[model samples]
Target: MKKLISMIAVAALLITGCAKELKVTTAENLKVEYGEELDNTKLFNAKESDENVKVDKVEGFDAKKMGEQEITVTFTDDNKDKEEKLKITVEDTKKPVIELKKESVGITAGDKLELKDNIKSVKDPVDGDLKYSDKTVEKDGYYIDKGKLDTKKAGTYEVKVIAADKNGNKTEKSFKVNVKKKETAKKPNGTGNSNTSNNGGSSSSNPSNTGNSGSNTGSSSGGSNNSSNSNGGLSNNGGGQKPVNPAPHQHSITVTGYPDVVYSNMWFEDDTEAMYWASNYEGPNGDWAGFGYSSDQCSCGMWSPYFFNVTTWE
Candidate 1:
């Protein structure tokens, strides 16, 4: 009976030694793409030569959500069971996001249309460096489909902008470009007249009265000097009509002796120096001429005629 017990123990030890052990050959930490299924066969080490050896169960792993997951792999060999627990990481499956900088922009007609300038920027959560492109909706007179603007007609237009990533994920945005007519420049000041006088001539009705001065000197019968008077005038409106807008011109005049200047109450008189304005001096009237006044009006005052170039607006 003792010998029979010894033989039974030896048989049990041989059976236990022949049984195969299950193991996982894959890495302890596995990474899988989102929305992908995990294969149990690839995660386990089973002897393909043995028909009874097979992957029995795989659980505790999900690829739908992005995070760390626990995966339990089990192998069965002839009713023997073994299990392996490991960690896996699931990544996002969604595409990148994109948006427009602005919904609309305004520009004048005949201006260059820079397509890229309108887009604020292209961004992606997973893919930071995204590809971008733009296109015009139509080949209309108001909008340019691409490149520099070719059309100048005033009208509203639309453009499509696209942002894409290497994963074939893409997003689109729309923009409205407004083309408007260009405005013209306005003339300086209002409708007024400019008439200037030269020498001792009196200014009647004149507009655009620039700087001008005039003076008159009287003489006594015995060659003695009489009292002198100075006059200056500025008129913005001349003769109730638009004053002649003269083109810019200049000329000079010389006097050997003082010439008597005719005075008018319409002008302002100065005891010392008088200012002459080209706008009020009609003597030069659309013609080039200069007006002169006494630099200093003493008891014996000297005066001379002045000349300057003049131009008239048509």
Candidate 2:
């Protein structure tokens, strides 16, 4: 009887070891963009303990759909079929694109200026074209950030256009609006007829009087008219010349060893300011100065310090 009990216990142990549960390793709570392609190899493991496993099929996953859903992955594990469920979220995180008609526009003072006219179009990859709005809180459209554009004043004003899509992705672009002073017509001089002789008609009646009158008219009127004409020419010449405002020079700077990484077409008052900005300008990675270095140590495996080249144009 003891020998019979030992055989039964050995059989039970063999059954338990042969029937061990198979646990599949899978990625949990995966997130993908709305239009990303699905790959089975990246989703889950295809082998268990050196045993060959194959992914047979996947279901309930839509690349075009935006939301969270449960996906079923079917695979053959060690000659046995099994299934695993995974939660995946599809989202739209792309920001909208803003195209402006002009980066800088000029208008005469007191002229009508519409802020929306500057925007050429606002388009989203998933949401199509976005509409214009007066307020910034609109989720599906764009709006001007600065309040009340003053076109009546003569000065330069900066305007920012902010666009947002349905998924809360946002993009911003800045532009300038220059308001020029209106020109007015100047009044003609009142001394134009002062050079005419008043005694010419009386001199025509008598020959003796004509000579005296002619001499007096020529002497007095010629001097007075010449003086008036000289002063008027000087005044008109001065008033006709307008003061010219110099255009801002375009400046650019590039990082050493990275030609593609550059800031171009930036406008500045002078080269001094551009140099200052380049010295302290911080980019996506870091500032131009001390690039590829951590404190005093060179992180790029060399003692090479990053240098910059600045170019400017009118």
Candidate 3:
């Protein structure tokens, strides 16, 4: 009988020792972007008795809502229910998108041009289509940065467009505006005149006294005639018009030695023009080298020294 009691006690002890408890491990806090759906597979890990367990469902979390919220996760282990609590935060960190109709726009000089005409749309995932704002300080719409747009000049100008969502998420993009010179009409040629004058007289009178030398004393009259003609020639070399100089040829310089520094479609009208533009180039992040051309060699260096060759085209 004591052996039987000992066996029963041993069995009970073994059963108690073999019993397992559900254990769940999860992050204390989760961060997600606005409009992102919650994914359960990435949330936590659950196991019981060295075996995997299944999550039944999750509660107390809304994906659409922004800000911090308490979340409760539920799972099942060995036909038993369990719950875990954590915090989730949904934020609007994504920037708005600015779509442009064209990367570069062309207009004649002295013509009216609106910056908004280049923009196709400005959209935010949460705020829909953004409106246009003249005030640069506003947060919910798009505005042009502080810069002058001179359509009266014939050159390339950069236009910066900034967009912001309702949550203060901002985006910036730029496009080029190429202003061209206007065409002029040509004038017609002028006419020239010529004049001629003739002053001459001829008289044929048979001088009978000439044959007879005796009467040579008769009165003899002689008259001389002169004729003059003046003709004016009009020369219309190019119709007295000024020669039209060709437009400034564009030259592209190839940059080398620096992989991090990138240049856009940049060109120079001439050596002087290139130096001037490079001197004024502000770069993308205020760290850029001004371009210089000397002795048929083109190079740029600010953060680091780099070299490039100049290519000319009409």
Candidate 2, 88: how far from true, in Å? 2.5
User: Which stretch of 10 consecutive residues in model 3 shows the poorest summed lDDT?
Assistant: 192-201
Q: Model 3: how large is the Cα RMSD against the reference? A: 15.4
Alpha-carbon TM-score of each model against the true structure: 0.33, 0.52, 0.52
**Residue pairs with backbone overlap in model 2:** none
Clashes in candidate 3: how many? 0
lDDT of 2 at 108: 70
Cα lDDT tens digits for candidate 2, 164-192: 88877899998767665666797987555
| Cα lDDT tens digits for candidate 3, 109-220 | 7988887888999999876899998888457899986376688867667889999887888899997776665556867544323121122222224586347545533424
**Residue 78 of model 2, lDDT score:** 53
Give the Å shift of residue 99 in candidate 3: 2.0
Ranking by TM-score: 3, 2, 1
Estimate the TM-score for candidate 1: 0.33
lDDT of each: 0.50, 0.63, 0.63
TM-score-wise, the better of 1 and 3 is: 3
lDDT of 3 at 253: 49
lDDT ranking from best candidate downward? 2, 3, 1
